[model samples]
Target: MSRIRATLVATAAAAAALLAPLAAAPAASAHGWITSPESRQGFCAEGATSFDCGEIKYEPQSVEAPKGSTKCSGGSSYTILDDNSKPWPRTTTGTTVTFQWKLTAAHSTASWEYFLDGVLYRTFDGGNKQPPSNVSQTIEGLPTGDHTMLVRWNIADTANAFYSCVDLHVVAGGTDPGDGGTTTPPVTTSPTDPTTPTSPGTCSAAAWSSSSVYLGGDQASYNGQIYRANWWTQGDTPSNTAWGPWTLVGSC
Candidate 1:
């Protein structure tokens, strides 16, 4: 009986030791990403732009890598972000703009850096303290034209940083400064010619909407062509023919 009791005591001690580190471990590492003016990952996660975004569609906040990289992915494994060929929707704004960040796990910060066309333009100190879930940063005196802005959220406690890339079509005196989140509306044909197709053939389906959900076999007209959805999808442009959910049925 004494020997059996000793074995049980030893087993309990070992179990407690194994559980100690588990209890001390930190919580899940959830990071953040830009929302307003929509980063590349943001558009992919929202399914509003590209359809070929691999794993980034699920993990927009995970574009984290070591510091000192200029690429959109920041030298992370998310190489899709570095592909500028993707049709990232550009936000139409004036010379001044405000970027909104959505933080999932706001860690201790070092500084926020912004680069326009690979040139450092602004940096905000983080005071070495944790930040709130929602943080907004405004950048002023931007030049007018198409520009790619790279944002970095450097962590004070770690060598890693979160990166986001935003494409903007800055006009001399464009959108209201207060309307930082708004995007340029897509051009559409007149609705008075509903019976008449925008192209050569008759439009047999409704015009595709970015906000509408399309299921399998559903048809929609886009870019003078009629497309059929292979499966359920939303926010995916119908003109994406290569491996997208849309299949070009014919010209409308």
Candidate 2:
């Protein structure tokens, strides 16, 4: 009887251990962030685009706050995002720009809003449904010049919202300030001749994982090349197909 009881107890312990991860999965409020055009949190999370970022440099997707709040940091511990005086990298773009968000854990959303200089710019209604692994929307009518863009994702079922900020430099269409009238002689080379290969920039900060769902602007290294996802994808190798989800960015 003692031996049988010990065996049963061992089996129960094993089962509990296997179920622990599922029970401890991250809550819906714990995930999400803007990646494309590189939000303040996104830039710090990758350890790129140097700036004095606080704790956001560690976990960009973790910012959370109640709805109707306009603070850039979303009341997160990483309050450095609220500092606009610090020079942030600007993304050169047009009036109509597509913004992307990555969601590690999907939640029912009330709406997504964009702000410019403390004014509401655009809104995307989510209809209280779970959002996709990746979310993107094109915003138009932005005037040319430097502008601060803030994106907010309001949770429908909860009072909290996620926030991200990006600096943009919009330019007028068809205005090309070419090479200042300077020209260089073209160098000729044989098509069949072998040449020394060069490095492909830098490898991704993280390894690619099949179990992980990547969103736009997320970088991963696979098979010696670093890639940025154009949208949401999983288990896709970088630079393997013309229309593949991954965009080759560098070499690992």
Clashing pairs in 1: none
lDDT of 1 by residue, 1-252 (tens): 999999999999999999999999654454888776778887777677746788777677778888878899999878989988777789899888878776767889999999999999999999999988667787899999999999999999988889999999999887633334332211122322222224557887899999997754478988888876644568998864444567666677
Model 1 TM-score? 0.61
- Model 1 stretches astray by more than 4 angstroms: 1-28, 176-252
User: How do the residues 156-199 of candidate 2 rate in per-residue lDDT, one tens digit apiece?
Assistant: 88878988888888897722111111221111121221122236
Q: Any idea what lDDT model 2 has?
A: 0.71
TM-scores for candidates 1 onward, in order: 0.61, 0.61
User: All candidates: CA RMSD in angstroms?
Assistant: 10.9, 10.7
Maximum-lDDT candidate: 1
Model 2: lowest-lDDT 10 consecutive positions: 185-194
